[model samples]
Target: MTVENASAPPSTRRPSAERAAALAIQHLLSRQDAQGWWKGDLECNVTSDAEDLLLRQFLDIQDKKTTHAAARYIRGQQREDATWATFHGGPGELSTTIEAYVALRLAGDAPDDPHMAGAAAWIRAHGGIAASRVFTRIWLALFGWWKWDDLPELPPEVIFLPKWFPLDIYHFACWARQIIVPLTIVSAKRPVRPAPFSLNELHTDPRLPNPSRRLAPVNSWDGFFQRLDKALHAYHKVAPRRLRKAAMSRAALWIIERLESDGCWGGIQPQATYSLIALRVLGYQLEHPVMRAGLASLDTFAVWREDGARMIEIAQSPVWDTSLAVCALADAGVNPDHPALVKATDWMLGKQILRRGDWAVRRPGLDPGGWAFEFHNNNNPDLDDTAEVILALRRVQHPDPVRVSAAIRRGVRWSLGMQSGNGAWGAFDVDNNSSLPGKLPFCDFAEVTDPPSADVTAHVVEMLANEGRSADPRTQRGIEWLLTEQEPSGAWFGRWGVNHVYGTGAVVPALIAAGLPAAHPAIRRAVTWLRSVQNDDGGWGEDPRSYLDEDWVGRGTSTASQTAWALLALLAADERESEAVERGIGWITLAQREDGTWDEPHFTGTSFPGDMSLSYHLYRQVFPLMALGRYLRAVQQGQSVCGTSDLPR
Candidate 1:
């Protein structure tokens, strides 16, 4: 919503990308924190605030200030129809609307309030609470608003399953695994807190309650899971008391072990909430250190302002943000030995995971040498962060090259070891794409498995080549995998960013950086794809809806970040001399704000492919700088820029 375009007609003399890039560089340097890192506001849906309020409600720690502030923020996001959309300017989301209404209710809004009525109307019109995701209904079941029997069956005994089993605890992507572990304990305990009021009005047909209990098709796998769930429910009632108690103890221990030093579980709200509630159900007191520390950790997620309104960040982005800032500064010609760069690199060096994590479950015996996406998520370092961090480190001439070299070598080795059999790299786990979760009746959202992705794999490939491993068999295998995965249209599927533009942006530069020449047909085809999708305004754009519908790929109004991705892709494919590149450069300079950052309200990061999205608030500022810096570097070097050399590698 903050983005701006020219109000007047095009000028004869536009600021060149190179000149504008210098202005942007100065703008970025002025915005750095005293601690030598950049942390932009990470904006997500109302669910975070809604969930926080619910967590507070469960803990009975409602404070007047936070409650009202979060309420005001939620109210501000309600649409004309009194519903909430997941991303800005998107259509209403049923689950988001239900949660927002519940949070507002917990904040003391009367049920008959106009906004509440409208939200209820929207919910009832869209198949009511039953139609929402399993996670949503599970939240409701806690407050006696929904029946526990109607929910999916998750036994605490899952924690005791052997790794050789199909649905072992490690089978899930780390985030989901964290959620499930604590949630299984919660499900087994089945604690119900009394609600102040019932939600009768939101139901579609009051006579037909407990929707989740309805039988699924007996012929389908979903139906079989339903039957299995029903059978488990029956066992829940008759299971031996001592065995169930032991299973709960095991689940609690599992959760406690993974809690971060700050007491946040996996550095995400959902896991922390589940951990807190599960422990409480198991008789942990509010005064217990785990409970106290967990409660204190949530305050970090709150973004309170002088306006007395607050928003919740789903998770922190320091590691990801700090690494990107390093690359941007390096590309803009900052001295690698600058105190800012030194401080950042030193901080990064300290964050590497030298100990094995859950990722090693599938990759047993692989040495631990990677970086997490957050400041404290040591239990789950990702391939993306590790690759990007190594790339950023390569750009900096650190005072201690021996240490930096050691980190790079370790990270590259660990990262390569985590690559899938297909030669692509996954984020947190290798070969994590077991299809059983998708077939479950409870899985209503997007893909949850951490499968190999083009964007992540490309970043790894670029990092590998930068480390002078281009001749290695592993590197060759990765290149062959990427070639096989290229789309028919010459674009690769972006499993992490928005869509084709981002995938193409990542792959082209990586292919080039890995020694594929611009003259290669693969590079030529990719360059053609980028040009063909260029917007009339001379930039590139892709909608978040592109994940929902492929038809929308590369077809939205241009934003600073997506345009930067397109421009970087073009520059990588040696298209700096093309008109498409010229116009894209023109668009970036034109969109630059007085503060030196470009406006981008649209989300470009993907969490679960099509379902969950995020807007990294600093992306507009950082990416344009990298794109322009790369363009300038390429023009100076005659053509082409390396993905891992600089420009947000």
Candidate 2:
């Protein structure tokens, strides 16, 4: 908390790291709310902003201020080529561009305007509307700009499928299921609002907007789904009227049942947006309590900036942010009984989900005690957040030890129960890796399956180790599974964060904490991999494109968050004295701003791998402090960061 210059030379390691860590800890503490929570802005691409405007237009509730502000934000995301991309420094994406263009049009931008005209030209050159994804087309069809028949058919009757069925609601990823169930009603009803303006300029040819294409070979998955879709379309014309009505009613009820206390379905904009549309189509009036509450929840996602641009967060992350903040603060020399740590721990305990959610479908006997990513997503407590929160809680000496212990026990039990048969943990659901959802023609945007990833499994493993369960049979199995998942290049795939850096950063520490030796072959290979990929400037950054191109793996311009992640892995492996480690620390200290924070403009967080990227504003702060704190501890204690376990229980 004292004033010091982090700009000290690299040779002066202790002073520089100490000053930088102190500045970060103070800055982070300043950000904590009175109720003991830290929330950073969760930023995604322009699609959320576009979809928000589209939702208002569909509901006939467009306000001038919101429209202008949203349009400004959307325009600001446009690329030099007049197209929008899903992530920073990525190629132009057809779907994102189309959505942003439509949102700007809704804000009253004329097609003939210079910027608008350039975007239209780019859209036309890229096969126009036909080249966009199915989700984008669905939005277009709602306004009569595209025909409903051209899109994939999603019959509401699918909701009647048994839980044992391949494509049942439970089989899809939790986020996808929330949106899919409501979309089934939308697809069945096919209601279209009248368009206020024509999108002829966005079409390659107005007369044949959706050109027909030949299906793949019958033996292929695409062909089978294509034929199935055709049959479903045929069923749409002749299905029994009574049965269809009953199915739509069932789907509508399903959507309403999952609404959280704050009226959000999963604290995600798309899920809430589509659910509202489904209910509205089924005759739910705008003034109805459920409808009104749902509408109000969408407003919470808007993050109005000082420049008057209104951007929309795809999902909120207070719970996730707070848990990591606690870990960072506690690691950075904050006292175990410090008020900040206690309040954060108390807040986290209160946020634990005590009721069963959709994850219980597969584990009916397991108790509910996991944590969700958002403030009010009780129905979907993710394993990643739960594991991290438990670790954070373990670091604090809370006033009520019984309560903390009880919470930790429940969390560990739930986490252990939620593990897949393969001995790994996914973010949300267990064994939610059904391939049917991805093969379906309707799901072309977000990842529909929730498979176990190294990062999540690592967190759970680390949490289990901290709880003295390191030698448990289940923990050993998880460790074995992680060993098998290592890539030939010595990195693991990062499902939730940006590429190899995040995954390797997460796995190394967990492995080390679980009793793996510093010189283990796997650890050595990972260290070599990390050092080989370090930026010439001595920090680490991985571009989102690594999810698609192997050439880009573990390569990008340095950022504070990513550099910290790599350093954490190194320090955990007893590499505090290595040149790579020292250079990384120097980069972090020199990169620190006068205000005790680092500026990270790249999309370091992730949602759907290559399809969607995110920028968690707090990642730039929390991770660096955590890494620095661990490094200082290693140096001061004359031991590995993991070996110095005298902080707290």
Candidate 3:
């Protein structure tokens, strides 16, 4: 399968290292959670074999029934060339294919099995064992399929660098830093053992590249970063023993302190699993509290199938899911007085954290009032949750005024404080605009560090404006930032949601809330862009490519969620009478599933751009409800809307 790469150039010129260093320090200072651990999302290709192996090793559930069920599911994903992809319809990934092949082997599939043979051939054809990433090679080395010397050096001594250094520990993204901290200890110790079988058949070359060899020249900036990595490796040897030991001990304690009750580190799947194994090799016993809890947390990550087999999800998202549901239901006109609404609000109120979390470091002195994305992820409280929760509480008429008011004050204050000097806000981080982290040669993904985005900032602005605080300086600056961030074509770049449609939908409403007149130039420009992009089916849809490619604008078959997003934008701009709104509403009504949900496969939310996408299942219901409710309200008020006659069938 062919996949297009749509990585955009850095929108601005590269920052000087001095400037970047200062920014990194500033960003780091803002991200310190009250609990004293830095946290952020750990993104990886979810189809990796690490997860499959984790399920078997931790749960001891490699029964034949479970094995065959999982085998069938994995085999079904094999591409025409007999390999697997990290993403749907994308090129075969070497690490993913290797891991999948190994996973099947662990499930008792013989190397000679037709499916296994096919996967082996694909691996050999692609540079086989030699072409896989360092992380993949290290995993193999752990089991002795590969040699320790074949992996890049990730010495513990690197952690000793002062904070001001260009490649200091703090320079890496929070996720990378967390994993690397523990990994440094594991690497310095360099422990290796044997796997059950040899991967000799998997390689076209019997020998792997020397880890010390320079593979590519330091030509471009990315190339320069790779050389910097090599220099760090050189420095690894001959480092002072005292400093090395101190850094390792500090890093180890750093990792240990963040371990959640459930044996997982930071309650994220990758860190918890990898760190558990790493700590075990460092002599932590299986029965130890940290290890046992980490192992048990693996169960929380598993989802049982009808076949009695299980697939491990990277992490659960109930808090994020629930918040979106509440907003959707509220927008759909579910009265705040409804029993379900009341129940949800009460539960949400209970969940509101009254004390500061790790975010307090980045947002020093702010009152502790925000929500997290997971029921238990206290280390990573998010702005998205805070905004949604505020909206939900505002709709609840019977909420205890004292508690609700206090929560609102804390949340608003925290959010305002979290805004970057640029006048926008990131989701889980603040002023996380350091460019050096993304320039690291070890990084290949887009958005290595979180920076404020149009969608998230817009949501926060709208939430604050709805609270009757639109006139505040912070809110006004946020509005100015949104106006400035808009593309020349009038569209806004969506960082957390899909492409322009999501960004436009969110920013338009926020602009209106910030007191921009309906006829404001920015609002008009955004409305025209939405109208121009509406699909032929009387709805709106944008492919994920929009995140990667500017040229893929206006692409994808119309879907219910995108259509609803479009309708909401037009409604916010008082363009409900337009043909685009008519068609958008028509698409939503026509596509409604029998259960009152809409069926669409495209993911509507983005995490790390170009790497992961999320299908917010409730987006269809909530957005349409919101759009339809507003449209109906306009009609009742006798507004001269463009397409009132074309309500969905």
* Top TM-score prediction, candidate number: 2
| Candidate lDDT values, in order | 0.84, 0.91, 0.67
| Local lDDT at 176 for model 1 | 84
Give the TM-scores of the predictions, in the order they appear. Answer: 0.96, 0.98, 0.84
- For model 3, residues 26-92, the per-residue Cα lDDT tens digits are 3333433433222222223435334557345433434576566666667766788878765444467
Report the lDDT of model 2 for residue 465: 89
- Count of residue pairs whose backbone atoms collide, per candidate: 0, 0, 14
Worst 10 residues of 1 by lDDT: 6-15
* Residue range with the least summed lDDT across 10 consecutive positions in model 3: 1-10
Lowest lDDT 10-residue stretch of candidate 2:
1-10
Instruction: Encode model 1's per-residue lDDT on 1-649: one tens digit a residue.
Output: 3233422232421345656777787877777777666788888889989999998898889899999999999999898878998887778999999999999999999989999998999999999988888889888999998988888788888888898787887777888888888888888888888988888888998887665455767998878888888899999999899988999998888888888898798788878888999999999999999899899999988888678889998888888888898888787677878777888888889999999889888888899999998768889999999998898888777789999989988998899899898888888898888888666655667675788888898999988888788888888888998998888888888887888888988888888888898888888888888888988776677887888797897788788888888888788777877777777777787788766778787888777776778888888888989888877777777767756643332
Off by over 4 Å in 1: 1-15, 212-216, 645-649
The TM-score, computed over Cα atoms with residue i paired to residue i, of candidate 2 is 0.98
Candidate number that wins on TM-score, 2 or 3: 2
